[model samples]
Target chain A: MASVYIPTPLRKFTNNTAKVEIQASNVDEVLSNLVSQFPDMKKHLYTSDGKIPSFINIFVDDEDIRNLQEGATDLSDRSVVSIVPAIAGGVDFSKEELARYNRHIIIPEFGMEAQRKLKASKVLVIGSGGLGSPMLLYLAAAGIGTIGIVDFDVVDDSNLQRQVLYGVKEVGTPKVESAKKRLTELNPHITIKTYNEMFTSANALDIVKEYDIVADGTDNFQTRYLVNDACVLLGKPNVYASIFQFEGQVSVFNYLDENGERGPNYRDLYAYPPPPGLVPSCAEGGVLGVLPGIIGSIQALEVIKVASGVGDVLSGRFFTFDALTFQTRTLNFRKNPNNPISGEKPTITGLIDYEEFCGLKAEKQVKEITADELHQWMIEGRDFQLIDVREPYEYDIVNIGAELIPLSDLPYETDKISKDKKVVVHCKMGGRSKKGIMELEAKFGFDNLYNLKGGVIEYVSNYDPEASIY
Target chain B: MPVSNVSPDCKEVRFEIASRDFLVAERLAEKDNLELTGIYHTHLIDSAYPSETDRMSAFPNFSYLIISLPNLRFSEMRFWRLNSNNQFEEEVFEILN
Candidate 1:
């Protein structure tokens, strides 16, 4: 007698019984008897070609039955034929989707399989900024099955310059909500999930693990590094891009090759970050308005290629572009032996303080005061100086009766700031004011500066909804 | 299966069992020469009568027993099933000695 032990997955077919003793002398007889007792188990145990598939391993007495003479393997009275389903369907596209992707299907190299793979892919885009705007537009247009957007910033008139995902109506609204509204209007078929929160170390892994791949559109170096480490640790490919004044760089990081070997990651290219103030941000060093659109489209193409095995993914190759001279270059880079994440002797295990690693002082370097707190202070007749570090045009639109000293003119007008009193500085939103505080503290050695948290936008949104907000 | 309060409705909760688990339950029932006939649940705020949501989400041809606990001192039990027109029709019951 041979005992067939059914795993949990196939137990339903066996009337929820774990083991069934069969009167069989060989491996084939044991399987046939088990299937005979439960007729539904035949298709689960055998392929259409009447052969056992590789995924389902058949073992007898801790030995592979295939190691013996296949079906003729002898089974003793004490033999246990274990049917184990180890740890770990047709999604046909609608007629409209088929028509939309007819161009892709027409290509012999890029056919229905690639289209299906694309429709099954779930890509998480980190930021809804300049790059995110164009990339998400194309992603939705192409009908990626699921797209996740992570952004916390509210839309402003400044974003309309390059952030094609929003309009005047979306101003003062969360970027994710705005992007979702725009992308949905573009293609209602694909699913778009919004994370109206910062993608920090605490929630980075939680969010990235849900998506099949990540297309990083984050602007800051802190988030760029965070995206890289999360993708590497999760063994997911990162479709990466970064844009400067008129130049942009694109590369696919931590990608697995056909042989299941990992390609060079972000650390392999630039092992360490440049000093905090060394590389100015896109906000400070303006991006050529159309640079992200061009680069972001390329990024979307790489993401689609990675999701669907259609063409050669830009995994090992780094592409750079300069709009001034219209120059384009593609260079090859390899894994660095000195890399900390993936090296002969690895050091870092999990995500660490990216701000400190980038040589920026950990956050809270600049003291901040919220609008509600400031309003309470004003009501109590608290003695404090409020400085508006915004352009005169913005101050003209609306102001909380603070002296206007544009950021460009802050250095020349430092004498106007009160040294004895606690100084609260603010701009359109909290970002520029934070930079203004950091600049004054570093250059002029002023210690009494406090950035107005969320700046005028928060003040108007929560405290004074009637007030005009940029 | 026990119910949870994750759903939007605070007054009621239903265990949305997976089809796989339902299939397993059916198979287990068949092994003992029985069948899955019905489900019973509780309503905290409303009476034992079926709510509109309950009728819309109900599976056909199964007796549904709803026990209402409107207050700490009183309790009521009623039986129901969906008719051919997909309306909840109350079923009369008897107590055995």
Candidate 2:
């Protein structure tokens, strides 16, 4: 009989005993001896492919049996074998977990080592809903070492469609607790840390720093921006995946490689925040139940790839999936010159009030109309004077029946223009119009000057498509 | 590294420098002989100067080409020919229609 020392986590596999004696010779024989006696321990120890589960490290005396002889390691009489789960309360495959992860262990490209890394990794999942549900479950099942979840919401009946982490019994319980219970049951070998509160800017940096990578499964913009800024400030890798009804976007941001070359952050792609209310949340628009499964799976893949240091990590690139057309598009975003991130570090030190930054909180200003409305006004012979504040080349292309007074030449044209008349200023795409408005208001002191929204792009839409005035 | 040989394909012969790039250039140069010359890489957002990292890391035995990306445009290309003294002399290469 060979005596095996079972660690704290794996002691449950050995009837909560620190040591168990089983009759066997080789490592395979030893496992078979234990399995025959316990019957229930087979699924806990061996993967579906008949190899040892990755999270459990077996050592003979002093040598890790994985590097020594694997499952084929021979055992002598009175030989000391240790079965220790790599993490404390970390992700461990129970017999059921081993069965569920059989397919992964069998794949040679991933095999045992990848699973071991998963078990040793500490991944903090930001939300326990939709995308977070699958992401957490898969990471747990994969045998990740420590899984920390930050969520304050309670499990709602509506969350059952996609949040596989919680179920009917967990309806009113807090999401973090419910998820913790389920994950612990799924694999008692994993350490499940739960924070029953929303992630805020004050705690974001500290919380994110503890884990190697943060999976942002958040649902709103405020949290998303806060998390992004915090990740950038703390220099943690943010594995970002967002879903909107039928579509999803995934990208990796803010982590340096071993060589000290900093990878791209979120601001490298999106320089500005999305206009509020323009982008609807998954709650309002509704997502296909299976969509999060696809996206969350990919997010898990990115986490594994990043943790393992094997595959090409998606940094500064967005992989977008469109369920409507069944097409996947990859948009490569290069580092923007005006990117709030400077030289591999974030330029925006702290999170700004994004609602204010996005003009969501700004009071409505003077009225504005579409190009079609302007055209209709012209057809009705309105008395307002139209002014073009575009560059010479832009004005040379197209102008909506306006007097050409380039922004640079605005001071020269100011004397000839009447401040009493209501002046409508426009440019190619409205950028120059804002500049013109500033110049006119601040420098020229023209109180009546108004900037056109969406500029000439709106104006050209009203013209006949067949006619070519050019 | 600077350009050792010059070949003209209406004023642009891809500049080749590094060992890997030289092998590629040599093979392409053999096939396209007279039309190909040296290769060039643009250093964008850096000074009109070469950095210490660039100078120390680069092979000094061969000539090198450095084009600042800040100055690069569709109409004009600025060429810096490095001398034996490690000093760069400017040569303007203009694209003619």
Candidate 3:
């Protein structure tokens, strides 16, 4: 008796069995016994001519039957007969391409067909910041044929930690240019097209039209909504992933299923963006260094799957990760009836001014004083309360005689702030202090607050350049 | 749920062959001075075909029997045996008066 070992993908026809024994003395008889036992498998195991396809190799105890006596190869008692099928091949991947992506190609779930599709697809990435930074690196490494990067801002020294795509040398350079250079160094086969401009309504449609898919990594709400609407209008799939502090979210929108029925868009999930400053930006909230590495990599994976036509994508569903608790959840969603772009009775025909749409139109300018003015105030010995709204950790690093009242503790401890005195509130770079001052004006009605223009950094830079920042 | 699931018009039904139940049955068979032979289950909306799920739960050498009650068609009862190589083969059985 010879034991035939059946591989997966064919197990459904074998009654979900892994091994089947046959009372056969030769390879030919063993196959006959197999098909007789599992009649449904005969169609899959053989060609239309009743002959085994060349892709299926029959082996008798580590020896192929073709290398032995062909089908007449005698099988010893208890011999293990294995039937192996070609998982991926047939000019589906080029010689060099296969060598580079051999590990990815071997996965039966993401085989050569998907690899070929990946090599033929183009994806546009918006804002190569935190989410875009890591996502672009993986996409370029994964062999996406062409990638378009759209960003008008230059790189800053602060982006080096989590934005793994940029190095210390790339600071003060255009993000799109640095990103393209770094990506090409990783894989030269794929083309990297850089659009050194804002992905606004003007160029959004034109740039998005060139790519089959768009990856939304923009940090601001206006651009996030802009990218979502543009992809919807262009009939392109948008892969959105955002990280805030220790938490991150990923979703696929405007994606078409097999039947051409489009999935939900961003508006379906949230018809309107949260009022400005309701959700603190990554710049203000601060993120764990490794959080984007995990979230953005998943974003990269989704783009590969969505573009290459493999794996179940995150369409019509939202996936979230909480690094603090190390928990992940996927919430399934559907199209909304009020989605302005894809829903019933569409209102937005094309891209409009997203600033007004996000309620950032009525900009409120807080009172401010520059570092030079503050120095003159110190020279004249101005009597004012210098309140440092930054955290104690930052205050401990460097402080010039300002009482530390961290913004987090301000809501509960607002009584400590003097309303009678002239208040000069300041933060590390004035953003947080501005927010603290706004909270004071809104809730406490203390209109005596004035934000330091460049905050402590500028004050330190103007007087003492040797004052090192922690 | 039997109360209200009817999209397919097939009247859905779920089945489970718990391990604890099997263990209790094995002990009962041992106490009765009988050998544990096989197991059986009813398929309310299916035929007497050996499903992959059914075959996977059976012992390699034990017999399996399915009693199907497909309401529209006549009820059927068939016997099966899981061979040494884990493959299933039908075994003949007859009802007697």
| Interface Cα RMSD of candidate 3 | 18.3
Comparing 2 with 3 on lDDT, the higher-scoring candidate is 3
> What are the per-residue Cα lDDT tens digits for candidate 3 across A375-461?
889989988888898888888888878988898988887888888878888999989999888888898898998999989999988
List candidate 3 stretches off by more than 4 Å. A1-94, A363-470, B1-97
lDDT scores in order:
0.82, 0.70, 0.80
- The digit string of per-residue lDDT tens for model 2 on B1-97 reads 2333221211121222222233334335446642223334554323234333334323222223455443354322445544557655555565598
> Which 10 successive residues of model 1 chain A have the least lDDT summed?
A84-93
Q: Write the per-residue lDDT of candidate 1 for residues A1-470, one digit (tens) a residue.
A: 98886655567687777678899999888888888889988877888897876446677766667777778899889998776432110114555676788787657687656777788899999998999999999988987999999998999999899998889998999999989988888888899999999999999999999999999998888889999999989999999999999999999999997889899999999878898999999999898889999999999999999998878889889999999999999999999888898877778789988878887875656898989898998899989999998889999877889989998888899999988899999999888888888889989999998889988888878877788877
- How well is each residue in A162-227 modelled by candidate 2, as lDDT tens digits? 988888999999999999988888877779899998797667777888898888998887777777
- Give the CA lDDT, 0 to 100, for residue A267 in model 2: 68
Best by TM-score: 1
**Which predicted model would earn the best lDDT?**
1
TM-score (0 to 1) of chain B for each candidate: 0.73, 0.47, 0.69
CAPRI quality band, candidate 1: incorrect
Interface RMSD for candidate 2 relative to the native interface? 28.0
For model 1, give the TM-score of chain B. 0.73
